[model samples]
Target: MSERVILTTSSHLEGYRVTEHIDVVSSECVFGMNILKDMFAGFRDFFGGRNKSSQAALRDARITCLDELRREAEEIGANAVIGIDLDYSEISGGGKSMLFLVATGTAVKVTKV
Candidate 1:
C-alpha cells in the first residue's frame, strides 16, 4: 500500500476526508511537506522589509510546527493529511519573533471502488 497519497482537487476518491473528528479508520501517514514557494512566502511575512533574521526565524517556525503536526498524525495512523489549516500569530513581546501552526484532519483507509 502507498504510504502517502496526494489527491488532486478534481480527483474523486472514497478514502479522503477533512474534518475535526474521525472514528474507526485504519491508515498510516508518513509526513507532510510544503512547496518551496510557500516556505518563502511565510518568511516574507515575517520580514518587514526583506530582513535576514525574520526570514530565518519564519523558516525555523514553519519547520518546527509542521514537524509537530506530522508527528501527531503519525501517532494516529494517517496515510495522507487532507484539508490542511494554517494559523499564524506574531509575537507580542518587543523584539520577539515566533509563529504557530496547527494541522487537523481525518485519517482513513481507502479500498478499491
Candidate 2:
C-alpha cells in the first residue's frame, strides 16, 4: 500500500481492529457532522444549559466508529488509511448520534519492491 490509493468512503467492517499507527487524511466532508452538532446544540439550548455529557458521548462514539473503519482497512493489508473522511448524524430519536467513518486506500501485502 503506497498510501496514494487511499480514498474517503464510509464502511463498517466486522472482525478487525485498528492499529496504533494510522495516517488520517484531511477532513473535507461536513454534511453529516453539521447535522449532528446542530442537533446536539438544539438539545442543549432547549434544556437551558450545556451538556458536556452529551458532547463526550458523541465524541466516544465517533472514535469507536472511526477505529473500526481503520481496522477494516488493516484487515485488507493496508499499510495506512488515507483520504479518510467522517460524517456524523443524529439517531435514536435525536437522543443519540450516529457516526459514519469512511476511508479509502490501497490494500496490498506490502513488499520491499
Candidate 3:
C-alpha cells in the first residue's frame, strides 16, 4: 500500500526539509441538510441551544475535504502538504441551505533534515 500523505498547517516541518515544491492542491466538499435537520436547527435557533446535526454535518464535510486534499497531494508525487488552510461557508436561499468547505495547501517533497 502507498504511504499516507502528511499534512501540516505550518509552512515547514519540524525535522524535515522540503526538497521540491510542487503545485498547489485543493479540495472542496458540499453538504446539504435534510428537512428534519433544518427543522431541528430552526428549533435550536429559537430556543438557543447547540445544533448537533449541523455540527456533525460540518465535521463530516471537513474530514472529507481534508482527505481529498491529501489524495490530491499524493497524486502529484508529494509526500507532504504544508501551509494548509481550511475555509467554510454557508449557502442558503428559498428555505434551503448547504455547507461548503474548502481545503488548500502547497504540495512538496520532504526529506529528514
Error of 2 at 69 (Å): 1.2
lDDT of 1 by residue, 20-83 (tens): 3333222222222234534565677787357465456566665665555554555566544444
Most TM-score-accurate candidate: 3
Q: 42 in model 3: Cα distance from truth in Å?
A: 1.5
| Two-way lDDT contest, 1 vs 2, winner | 2
lDDT of 2 by residue, 1-113 (tens): 23432333423223333443333433222113355576767788898787675566566665665556556666655654543555555444354434433333433322232
Kindly report which residue stretches of model 2 are placed more than 4 angstroms away from their true locations once superposed: 1-43, 47-49, 92-113
Off by over 4 Å in 3: none
Q: RMSD (Cα, Å) of candidate 3? A: 1.1
TM-score, per-candidate, Cα-based: 0.48, 0.44, 0.94
Residue pairs that clash (backbone atoms under 3 angstroms), model 3:
none
Better of 2 and 3 by TM-score: 3
Order of candidate numbers by lDDT, starting with the best: 3, 2, 1
Worst 10 residues of 2 by lDDT: 24-33
True-structure RMSD for candidate 2: 10.8
Poorest 10 consecutive residues of model 1 by lDDT?
24-33
Residue 55, candidate 1: alpha-carbon lDDT:
54
Predicted candidate 3 versus true structure: per-residue lDDT over 37-110, tens digit per residue: 99988899999989988999989998999999999999889999999999999998988888999999999999
